[model samples]
Target: MKNMVEIRWHGRGGQGAKTAALLFADSAMSSGKFIQAFPEYGPERMGAPVQSFDRLSDEPITLHCGITSPDIVVILDPTLMATVDTTAGVKDDGVIIINTALSPAQIRKEMGIKGKKIFTIDASGISKSTLGREIPNTPMLGALIKVSKLLDIEKVLDDTKKKLEKKFRTKPELIEGNLKAIKRAYEEVKGE
Candidate 1:
């Protein structure tokens, strides 16, 4: 593990990016690592742009600050590609995880992104095919875990499953489907 792992999340207001960051923080905490997770900006209304951040370290995390140069950038909404610069300020070796069907090469070429390791997953496709929803944050998080080596996939799934249990508990059939989405995403990403 590096000295620290910083993540920048881009998503629309109701896309669960903030929840994803918090869930990732909670999951990393379960791994006994110290972490900081929070959202930037105020009052995110539905369909509006928003950004969230997360930092995880083996040692106790003391710097409770917003992420500037991120080690990993997760794009939760593909539409944001035209609206925001998602790859700006990322570290040279940083990993960018995007929720799109586009290949890494295509994304790099289209976006003209120069630095960092790029990983792309059709998270929306996975979510729609497996969970019947457009929310791909969980699947994307699983891919992030695999690519960035940020957290133990099993631990993340365990913690995230618990956190999401309430919503799917009533529809017991959906639980397994969601888990499958996460696993599928973890397997799909070819990280650099």
Candidate 2:
């Protein structure tokens, strides 16, 4: 990984963008890295577009503001790409990971962005099959880690399972589904 990596996530209010961001940060921290995870809320309502930011570095983060230019962008809600410019301040060669069934070529053309590295995954499909829900944030986290190669997958999974166990002590299926969704997405993400 680079000295520092900034990730921006785009998703609906109800989706797990905030949770994914925090989990990524926490998991990465377990690997002995400095991290910051925060959410930017809009209207504080469900289904409303929202953004979450993460800063991961080998050194302590000195900045405490929004991430304008991200090294990586993860889109759990592809519909947000139509309304929000996910690449606003992103580097021209930055990697973009989107949860969509569409091909990377199709998204590139639709967004009128060419040459930037974009990856697409059927995270919604994976989530439906594994999580029994349409939420794709956990899966997107898998794709993010796969493409960025910042945090080790096993470490993230360990942290995730520990966290989920606290929230779902009696529900083993829910935790398993999340683990399945994440691992499936990690292996299935396609890049261009």
Candidate 3:
């Protein structure tokens, strides 16, 4: 039982950023915690940038406002690094997970981030290598779970699998591959 934690996600549309947010919230709620998950949309197209949010708490959630200061930020698209302020409103102690090949030093320098934990993972690389595609949301979610240590990893996987099964009901092969992608990415993330 910890204090509330808020997470913001940055990605392009159709990248599963929203799905990742929902999956995290659903997993938290299933653990009997209060949770909120939603997305902020614009005129964004499939490849256009977007943002999603999640709030998890041990107590009942009464606030309906968007996250102003997230405890964790997950960047699902490396290209968003130049377009979006992914670090906006993050707390000093917050942790940021980015789907990039850059090291912490490079990320800190490039993103102009200071005084927070920066976790960099080549999620796209993991996804392409393991799942044979460019879909990176699940892999980035794996890295988030690893870096933030906010929820139970096994629970995250279980819940993600269950959710994906229903969402991809007509595509069992995708479901299986996504499950494996999550597992592999989760195991691959490196943290200090």
The TM-scores of all predictions, comma-separated, are: 0.93, 0.96, 0.91
lDDT for each residue of candidate 3 in 96-169, tens digit (9 for 90 to 100): 88888888778888777779888878888878876788889888877777776767888877887888788899
What are the Cα lDDT values of the candidates?
A: 0.86, 0.90, 0.83
Models ranked on TM-score: 2, 1, 3
> What ranges in model 3 sit over 4 Å off?
none
lDDT of 1 by residue, 61-109 (tens): 7786678999889999888988798888988988899998989999888
How much does candidate 2 score in TM-score? 0.96
Query: Pick by TM-score: which candidate is best?
Result: 2
Weakest 10 consecutive residues, lDDT, candidate 2?
41-50
Give the TM-score comparing model 1 with the true structure, all chains together. Answer: 0.93
**Residue pair clashes in candidate 1:** none
Residues 127-147, candidate 2: write the lDDT tens digits: 999978898989888898899
Which whole-number lDDT from 0 to 100 does residue 65 have in model 2?
77
Query: Cα lDDT for residue 30, model 2?
Result: 94
